[model samples]
Target: MSTPKTTVHYVEDKINSWQTRSPFIILFLASLVGVATGLIGSLFQIGIAHIISWRMGIADSEFSNIYIKCLVIFLITAAMGAFSYYLVKKYAPESGGSGIPEVEGALLDLRPVRWKRVLPVKFFGGLTALGSGMVLGREGPTVQMGSSLGKMLADTTKIKNKESQHTLIATGAGAGITTAFNAPLGGILFVIEEMRGEFSYTKSSIKAVFVGCISACIVYQLIIGSSPILNIGTYISVPLNSIWIYIFLGIFVGVIGALSNFLILSTRKFLDLFYQKKEYFFVLTGALLAGFFGLLTIFLPDITGGGFLIIPNVIDELYSFYPLLILFSLRLIATVICFGSGAPGGIFSPTIALGAILGVLFGICARTIFPEYDIHLGTCAILGMAGLFAASIRAPLTGIVIVIEMTSSYILILPLILTCVTATFIAQTLGSTSLYSEILNNTLDKLGIQRK
Candidate 1:
């Protein structure tokens, strides 16, 4: 028989051993989340591509009646949008809109993660919304769904620790971003910067994020190939003297980014007046918006979709200044409408496209004013991509790293840092809140959850 002191010591040792091993368990789970997110995200991308290609192929097929072809396309896209909206309304309202805010809320324990509903709802709904040519991104759905998967694993595996749950959720979110953009470091930085407040940042948690990001990237590359998302030709180093122009561009993007945020939030609020938490009204609004975009996509393809296709054209100067300006204006409006209407998509790619447009416009004018510098317009476009993201998201590091990784333009780091930092500083100075934070606050308010 053991003495009382020996029994107590034995129990202490057992507890200590479990405590030491628990982190490894959590890390292993995080890696699993990463692999799952990567495969799902890749499949999501493939599905969207097939849908888009099928739609375009049909549109281009030799048909006797052109008007009928157009009509058929519009009807098909509109139906897709309607179906996606219906799913969100009936099955998972929380899956509507960019799911990033929801993940952030979940991390803070301010929201619940119903993965069974969210996974299916976000996956299919996002496919429909994106395929319908809405100015939305896949990243939002991927991140939300990934985080939901993490939560599902935790619950199923009986991970009772709150901190562990938070870490896994964040890991999945980071991995989702990695899979979406093929930027592992950017994904890791996203968790650190964008989700800073909610992310635990413990040694084990950070390592888990790393593992998840790497795993997600590996899986994504195996499926999607290792090419950068944007294949804009390599840009030469920006001249040192032209750094001032980037600063000015940064300031410009800061104002525009602030304006963009205001428009997005304002539009969402206005739309909410009609929705009033009525599922039918919300779904109807989304469908109507989708229908409109479907028609627009058939006509002005430049301003529709998630904005990736437009970036290369913009960087290549395919459109002159006037047309670029017009495209930018239209896309700004489309982005606000699609995102504010609560489509199951993200504003991230749209925002980056806007920045590229704005940067192109600025570059055009700059070249006209200063012919001596012979500035590379592509550089400006690149800077704008990071600048606007930095200002709007208030996550400059992630923005910079993302731009660098996406473009493979590490030589432009100095200019990127200058522009992104300036944009973020100006946006903050102008009293603009980070986009995700604003969205999260709005969500919590709607749910009547008070912040601690």
Candidate 2:
């Protein structure tokens, strides 16, 4: 028989051994979350693409009566929108809107994850909403669904540790962004910069984020060929003397971004006043909006969808100054209508498209004024992309890195930094709230939960 002291010593050693190995175990689980997120996100992307193709193919098929074709397309899109809105109303309301706010709330332990409901609802609802050619991006659904997966894994495995849960969720979120844009650095920076308030920057957590991002990127590349999301061709470096031009562009974007945020918030509030009493009306309104956009898509495809198809064309100077301005104005209206109506989509891509349009307009005017500087409109478009994102999101590093990764134009780093920094400063000086923060507060207010 062993002495009492020996027994005590043996138990202590066992406890120490398990403690030492627990971090590795958590990390392994996080990696699994990353892999799962990547697979699901890629599938989501493929599903959206397939649906869009099918819709377009049907529309383009030879039809004896053009009116029949329009009616069929409108009804189909309206039905899709109705089903998507129904999912949000019936299943998981948290899955509605750009899910970044929900994820942020979850990080702070202020909101319930409801992963079982959210995962399915977001996946299918996003497919329907995006498939109907709404002005939305997949990043929102992917990030929300990814984070839900992490929470599901944790709950299923019965992990009670708070830090581990937070780490895993953050990992999944970062991986989601990585797979969405195929930009690993942007994913990592999003976690570090965008979720700074809720994320705990522990050594273990940081390592877990890195592993998750890398794994997610690898899976994404394997499925969706490795190419920059935006294949805009390279451009000559901006002349040193032209740096001032970017500063001006940044200032202009900063004002527009602030105004955009105000309008989005106001529109949401205005719409809510009309629909808060009858939830079904909100859903039907969304359907009507979707149908209207369907009509618009047939007439003017440029202003609908996630705005990706129109971006490259805009950068190539396909539109003159007045046309660019008109396109921007129409898109601004579409973005506010789609996003303000609480459609399960993201504003990120729409903002990017608007910024690109504004930049091209500015560039066209600049080139006309300063004929000697050899101004490249494409360069201005790229800068505007990052500048507006930086100002609106208030995550300049993430915005800059994402634009660089998506465009594969690291040579514009100086201008990107200058533009993003100036935009951020001006936006802050103007007292504009960060987009996600405003959304989170709105959500919390609705829940009757005071911020901790």
Candidate 3:
């Protein structure tokens, strides 16, 4: 026993002693990347939460006059939106969108990863944009910022090898996602499954991603607590006899997903035409957009923000069929506008919220028609999330894993799989492509930067 322990120690020491971008050094850098990414991601979440709570509190508060309250809300959100839009437009133009495409382009050497400009712009811009009652997610800024940190660290450590730099950058991206959803496995799978063509698969690269993901999750939990990202809560298992119902649910969700993608792309083109007319007007449009959403937060709170709070309410069956349908339509429109306007935010959270709404809608109808069978509405909401995401993003495995890890519905893995696969198949059959891939191609076309 003593000899075995000594040999193990010897091997560890020898590995640690290796330098110059060796496996040990690379992995060590990856952990550092994770720690830093987690710290920034936690801070971003905290700040956004504070901003939203403060804004919404006043919106819901009883005031002497409603006009004054509306004006105050509008002004506050407009200021935040203006600030965010100005930062991205003036400092880092590339920080305008999800930033995932930019990172992917950097990995393919088709785009520049200017960390110095991106870090501050994406961080502050995303914080303000997401907090200003915009229907946006935090994952976009965190993922981009995480990858920026990877590059920053590589440059600081004088790691000139391109492949090693790629490893660290990819690690940071994974770690950032892990921090966002508190899902380490989901983060790693995002890089592996979603970025399959870009990420280099090697024993060391996979190990680095694992190390980064674990470290990021540990640091995030240390600061934010180890809680599930969504509040749907654990639901009971679904009956096998009712499994066929999920396939139809998936088909519905896939149609919605594909429609969402088309709307976003078309919206961007339409908005770009406006920007061509006058750039400052385009920036001011962000402020006006934020102001409108802020007003809605007071009146129609259902469609404001990233839909995190509303998801639980929908899952608990708070709305009737007509109300739910209206909410879903408005939210889908809001999500597309916010993201397509080139706001520094993610579509992930809003997309999940839409799925939950669809799920609950389907559940209500199903239970009414099939009163004999036990239909779990909450379970449908969960499957809606995974299915819609898989369909739109074209990454079924990542969507399934992410929903599983975020919701802790491990017992429903089979259901999740069936829903995601069916959803992706339907989306593809309907002529829908991966959302990010098309966006990246469009950007490259505009810039005349051909992919290498």
Candidate 4:
């Protein structure tokens, strides 16, 4: 009996060794992560939309008075903000901010994973914060949550190898982007460009990221259908002579981008002062600010949410120069306030919207200034997308690819590249740190803020 058991164990070990070394098996598992991430991310999006719409329905009716509406929106948003804060304060403080930093930190093994706590806290907490109408992006939270899912998969599979662990984390991050944008290439580029420091980028890791992004995209399309997130119609590219305008636009965006980063960091510093010892007041203030945005949504409508709805409107020449300027100014302030409040949303979408508005304004002004040079508003809008993203995040390649994917405007690649490069250079020269890393450092300096 002992001899027979030993033989069986030896055979099993041989089989396990072969399976572990099989490239195909690794690829298959990575693809599995993609599918899971895509499905989960899509569900997350759908869930958030449902919640937002439901809340809006309640706010739109029965609260006819502007003052009353503002008050109610404020209270509701405050509660949501407070709830999000409490979750971060209690369970996974590293889950706060954009979450991309935590993902990066995880790759460096500087963070600990309590996915059981973070995954739920970020998901539900994010929903509450985002649904409250703060000017936050969903992509950041989604990335964190998706990566957490990857870690979960690794744990369940008993993957002990460091290489496999890195591969899986990359898989989750790629899947998160794919699910968010339905752009597989963009998702992969995100890992390469935005999280380069955290990424190992071995052949194996690259394959895993590729597999995960593609699978997530497939899953998302199966559910949401393969359509660009923004349904902007066909846009004619700017003429070669007109391309210089985009370069100039990029330079302008660089200055604004640097300023924008400064403003955001400054806002955080200011808000931190209020929240440091006064936790309840801090939470309440966040709620009140969200409520204010909620009321503004009902009244202004253009200044609320993630700012996606406002992009097309800004680019379509629906408003004149002065009005566009006003919109830009107000939205910028609102964006800073909403984002600085420590909500579980992203600044990506909002920054895109801001850039679009700036481009449109620049286009209108340039066209008026130079009648001989025909300025394409749509082209400006696209450039704006890349420039703003590059300026704020300091990741030009990711910004360019993401905008292209979101708009399905591959024809603008040259201008996009030029503009993104210029924007990134300008922002970097001005000395603004990458947004996610900055946020992560902020969270870490606070004692008890453990990242994973």
Candidate 5:
């Protein structure tokens, strides 16, 4: 018979304890976390680029015979996807999808950070899934891995201060985005804006975020060079007369962003319903989707892969209205399916591309309609990216900063702000909650984790 106190203690809810008076030590550890995150993020970026290049090379050149080429591509991609899903299922299920939700849950003490399992699984699994030509981004995995690294260091160093741990994790996450997109300020703002209610903002925590972002930026620049993430050439600021046009663009992408979120949530529930009967089918489904997208990559590469590389082309108006529309529709579907299927990747890159395409399409019509005013199509594409991101993530400031940083289009800050803010307002009015927050809530509910 167990003692009453022991029984009570065993059943009691666990809480993370906090401490103070270690600002210097926490700052130092935060820098270390940023460095580690940067190194891993850079390597992850390089690895994915290599795999994508290899895959594209084979598709473009090697197998002259169509059947043989298709077979090889399918086999390669299917194997990659299978391996990624297998790792998520066996080693770390928390790494199954865009890891941002898990990190958010961790921040609020609603989830566990199994770093030992998450680090390797997320690094390799994300690499394989994104490399296999899925419409996914590396940023999500990097962020998750960064938070894990923070927790790993805390655990190893025996840092029992819960507040310090939270700060470190926040720092790591901020640095991870900086490394992923080469946007230090945007990364810092992301932590402040997107994580507003969750983060315990303090003087030391803010300083730690800054230090971590700068360190991550430096490390990433050392490895990946100091260039912006996207090579979309800068454009002249939109004429005052044309600024109002972007509001329409914002409204359009906002509605689409809401629909995208709905689709993602719906797909997850539908898949889970079917998956409950046969757990083994999950990996099979992922591999099949990868193989299907691999084939699509050969036929029409625009709709396949993360939307980063295609941004420059879209900005340049490479695709006409009909083709761009088809590409956008196909990619929207692919992005939602790939992300919703529990693949360890992100929706950021894909969303950016879709927004750009949609923006360009809208621009084509706008230019024709308003022949009196000079409108820049590329600028419209950039506005699209910012607006959609702001709408989907509900972080207008972060979206504006990240768009400017990624494209180095500083002259259009005013337009970016207009688009982002309007889009956010429209999204909120339409009842489209934050994507990551919704994902986190759904995830916690599914796991039967209650938080008040």
Candidate 6:
């Protein structure tokens, strides 16, 4: 009996030793990935800004006329789009979607992590597509590239443990969002909310994600100077009576969000049918779209890029409701076509913008119908943001966190909660799943890609 007791105690000691060692090692390795993700993310942002400024400088110089500037922009964007299309079509076709979905899939061993191909392709390809003034956001590409970088480090260091590999992947992703918006809490929330299906949320993983987010934010602040992406001014708190209005706004956004997703899926299917495995068709289509958008950049700059610059203007009433509506509709269509065409762009920012527009319209209507409430249109704008995004993506928590982080208006959390929850419920009741997951599944179906 004494010998048996001694053996059991020895086994217990070994288990405890392993448990203690694992956390320490994971934390240390996760920190390394965090620093790399932060540095790479910061550099990527700076690089894109520099590219855009340089092109604009050349356009402003005596060497380039109006026609010459147009020509240069067209060629640059066309070539960029063509190259980006080639990479997505040939190397990692699964990378065509928002990349968030791919990360989710990867966690479940449902997708491969081609770090070597994806990291470079998404980095430079995203730079080209974004810098060319395509209506794309850098956030999606950054997340994909950040995750790839994590995979690269794991492979290079001969990380044999599956848990270790997955931990780094999530860590990098958190860092990516952190760097993208200079919002650490948002980064953590994104992983927890959007990637819930894939992320293995453990005590250590949560802590690691937090660490990565903070580190990435520090790097981004150092480079970008710590400012909110949008300066919509301070917002008045939403009264309890006015909260129901946000719910109604959420329902309206839900309808629109459902329609937006339907269109995107339909457009994707049409492109698949038309292209019919012809890579050139894909590349040429991208080039043509890029050229057209580049032209818009020169003529009507409001209709281009991720639409961040347009939000504050709209909120400030810089554009009349009618014009804003028209612009909103046009951008909606452009966003669908551009994203559906798989042009290395993201619909995230555009979706938020669309929601803002809808909210503004709703607010104006509410004010006219019931002027005694002293309603603020900007609050509706914020609510609409969470609502549309929640309705479209079916991730209300993520939408809420993202909007709050982007605008730095955490005071409206209650309204945001009401809007996002209402929108998500309505959208689901009306039959729409998460947007990114749907797109990822569609892409996988087209490619005949599968995971056991």
Pitting candidate 3 against candidate 4, the one with the higher lDDT is: 3
If ranked by lDDT, best first, what sequence of candidates would result?
A: 3, 1, 2, 5, 4, 6
Judge candidate 1 at residue 192 and give its lDDT: 97
TM-score for each model: 0.95, 0.95, 0.95, 0.92, 0.94, 0.92
Which is the better candidate, 1 or 5, if ranked by lDDT? 1
Residues 1-452 of candidate 5 have per-residue lDDT tens digits of 89999877765523112224445778889899999999999999999999999988888886668899899999999999999999998899999888888888888998999999999999999988999999998889989998899899989899998888888888889998898899999999999998887889999999998998999999999999999988877688788977888888888988988888889889998988877889788899879988888888898887888888788888788888899898899999999999999999988888888889988998999989998989888899999998999999899999999989999999999989988888888889899999999988988899898855
Who wins the TM-score comparison?
2
Kindly report which residue pairs in candidate 5 clash with one another: none
Tens digits of lDDT, candidate 3, 1-452: 46988999988777767753467889889999999999999999999999888888888888899999999999999988999999988999999989998888888878888999999999989988988889999988889999999999999999998888989999999998899999999999999988887878888889999999999999999999998998567878888988888888888999999999999999999998889888797679889988999898888888888888888888877898999999999999999999999999999889988988998998898898888889988898999999999998999988888888888898888888888999999999999999998889999999988776
Instruction: Predict model 2's lDDT versus the native.
Output: 0.89
lDDT per residue for candidate 6 within 1-452, as digits (tens), equals 56988999999888779868667666766777777888888888888888777766755667436788788878877887788788888887756756887887788777888988888778777777777777777778778877887788889889988777888898888888877777788788888988888788889888888877787788778777788877899897888876777778888898889889999999988998888867489878878887788778778888888888788887877877789889988989888988888766567778888888888888888998989898887888888887898899888887888889888889999989988888888888889888888877875676688743
Q: Could you tell me which 10 consecutive residues in candidate 3 have the lowest summed lDDT?
A: 13-22
Instruction: Give the worst 10-residue stretch by lDDT in candidate 6.
Output: 55-64
How far residue 53's Cα lies from its native spot in candidate 2, in Å, is: 0.5
TM-score of 1: 0.95
In model 3, state the lDDT of residue 361.
93
Candidate 6 Cα misplacement greater than 4 A, ranges: 1-22, 58-69, 447-452
lDDT string, candidate 2, 1-452, tens digits: 99999999999888779868656777788788889989999999999999999888878878899999889889989999999999998999888888998888888999989999999999999999999999998998888988998899999999998889989899989999998899889999999999999888998899888888888899899999799999999987777987888888999899999988989999888887878788688789878988878867788999899997898999887888888899999999999889988899888888888888888888998888888887888898999999999988899999999889999989999999999999999999899989999989987897799987
User: Where does model 2 exceed 4 Å of error?
Assistant: 1-22
lDDT of 5 at 275: 74
lDDT of 1 by residue, 349-439 (tens): 9988999899999999989998889688889999999999999989999999988888898899999999999999899889899998998
RMSD of 6: 4.2
